[model samples]
Target: MNSRRDLLKTVGAGMLLKLIPVGAFAADLVKFVDVRLWPADEYTRVTLEHAGAIKYKHFLIENPWRMVIDLLDMRLDTTLKDLTSRLQADDPFVQQIRVAQYDANTVRLVFDLKTEVKPEIFTIEPIAEYKNRFVVDFYPKYPNDPLLALLQKEDPMLREDEISRALRLAEAETNGTLKLESGSAGSAPNTEVAKTEPNAPVNSKPKFEVRRMITVAIDPGHGGEDPGAIGKGGTYEKNVVLAISKRLKTEIDKMPGMRAMLTRNGDFFVPLNTRVKKARSVNADLFVSVHADAFIRPTAGGSSVYVLSERGATSTAAKWIANKENASDLIGGVNIKGTDAQLAKVLLDLSTTAQINDSLKLGDAVLGNLGKVNRLHKPRVEQAGFAVLRAPDIPSILIETAFISNPAEEKQLTNAAHQQKLAEAIAKGIANYFAKNPPVARTPLT
Candidate 1:
């Protein structure tokens, strides 16, 4: 009887062990699922995707410059080890990465640096097509001024000529002798430097105009982690828009008295507020954001233009596009703790009526030109509350190059020749706007 009772007890213990969840023991250690690194002149971002929430602590060390991160309750597995191989030769921040098991329950990652950096580390909750993420951004200790960098790109001789002409105009305008008249088509408004008196000496020291260089901020929408939209043929909206923006920049640069600055020159995520801030920092005269539209129905095709609307969107479709574009921050994985709250509040609170009026004029110009390149999505420009277009002082417009969701349009968007045509048309429109409404003097020509 005792032997039979012992056998029954043993059988019950085995069944109980079998019934316990197999993952119970493993749940304590979070597993890394993927890793990515994006390197650019502005900053370098390191992202670690994992199965669940993770606890981590990081520190920076100087002398040779290094960053160290320790992940608690994690295992150094293949996914984590793969981080060592992701470093690129041209990375501006990190020289290399080393991963190891610091302790039985901790994984340590060390980043050897190429230079001193200001690092921001944060986490993001899971969103569409992404799991929990740990992100680290390495920024330069002393950031380069975008405006200064832009000025350095111009030819010294040409810059001097511009300054001299602007100074002459300024002096003449001050003397109340300057007469401005509209220029020929596709040209800047002609400045007529008339004498205060008909008998004024021709050789008298010419007072220069106070006109400063016109700066246009060209923003390529949805980059880095935010692919904007994906087509059935796997075309990424980010790539298509970036290509077009670059082409547009080249075209703009060729115009006299004008220069262009790109919000992002590479494949990296920039916050919407940051994009606005960059434009403001450069004292941009106009802001043009380039993007490729996408829709649920693959049949949706055509180009569209949008400007900021203080009251509401122009139509249901406009509202939908605005909402989708606003959600870019979530998918792009902004570090909530590191965001500029004050800047964000200012962008959202400021009255933009004057800005909107100018933006509509600019949008109309661009939309008219876009119709020449492709079918128009809307015969006129639409209005929406795009966060990227909320710069209260600057006239901003968002251009949907075409519907990338349509197979036919996707093919055109990817073609280099079509992209150039789009760039030329947009550039012509900008020239037209400038001809009609000349840029007012902001700073004295230096």
Candidate 2:
């Protein structure tokens, strides 16, 4: 009787299990909407932007130095497949990307690396036009020294004695300390060889005599993923500003005893803080950030120059403009998690009274010159708390070449000839400022 009861109980349990569906046990799926890759000299970044939240894990593989990323509860989708088309042959780190279904409910990604890399992985919550972003950055274990980069290029600052001699010569020209014949621009002094453009004039009258080369850092605002303000005619702010900045660089390059370095020479995203650090690294005598502005009202248009305000912005519009410019890092997708908070804080708090004073003079000179070529938004130099201009020791100014949102101004900005004119105006302004206010002799950086 006991054996019969036990066998009946086992039969009933088996019958009940067969009634359940197999699909009920499957995991929930996560869809991938987009993937982007940004390969820069600083590091290589791979971003997976998806519709829904994702659960993922990554690990390093040896011998070949591959990075494996596994997404849980996800299947291979077309969006993920498109990642292959985005790979560039010139990528500094990643050789290629491979995707496969690692198991029943997980999709895996393998990154073939060109060399050993220190990888940083983090996730950013959805912001602006972006969805949830899973970011992977391959940074070299040993980052390159910024000073080394400066040294690799031509040094842009003068020694103490050089500055003193230049000052004495300048004072002599103005204070009647000495009377030297004013030579046409492009004409070299007896001491040095001059490289002049075929159509350009040489340094006709160099009132300031610097013993060492004077370096200026020209920064073109917004690039790479950051398109900046878009014009109605389809001109991108990044491209326009870059063109203008490059023209300005060429003009500055031709000046005797003065050299110029660009913050970026290509279409790539550079962090705002990095831009500041770059100016400092090269020991720039002056920093000029070139940009094209946009406004909510299409009728609102004109060029403006801004210097850092120690307290508050000069006007409400100035504050709004500053806030908008500061948003580039967010739109361009900075790896905020990897940023140095302390360093960033220091940069933000670094604006000194002397820096602002010098910046105002520079802004006035540029603003005055800009009016000659383009309509001035404000008659006087505007003051705002612009992050790119916060290099405490460097005299910096931000110039808005024109309002790209305005139909008329957009046309002006897009014209190559107009761009050259703007560049020349700015170069002239810089030359004027340096002529009167010679840079003080700074100790060489260790």
Instruction: Identify the candidate with maximal TM-score.
Output: 1
TM-score of each: 0.84, 0.78
Off by over 4 Å in 1: 1-30, 156-211, 443-446
What digit string (tens of lDDT, one per residue) describes model 2 on residues 1-446? Answer: 69768866767866657543433433233467688888877788788888777789999997989999998878788888888788899998999999998998789999999888999887777777778878788888787655445444443564545444544454443344344433445544332212222333365434333344578999999987678999999989999999999999999989997888888888777889889888776568999999998989899887899989888999998998899889988877777776767767886665389888998999999988888988899999998888888888888999989999999999999899999999999999999899989876543322
Q: Give per-residue lDDT, candidate 2, residue 219.
A: 95
Model 2, residue 146: C-alpha shift (Å): 3.9
Reference-based lDDT, each prediction: 0.86, 0.81
Per-residue lDDT for 15-111 in model 1, tens only?
A: 7576556555565455888999989999999999998997999999999999999999788889889999999989999998999999977899999
Cα misplacement distance, residue 216 of candidate 2 (Å): 1.5
Q: What is residue 357's positional error in candidate 2, in angstroms? A: 0.6
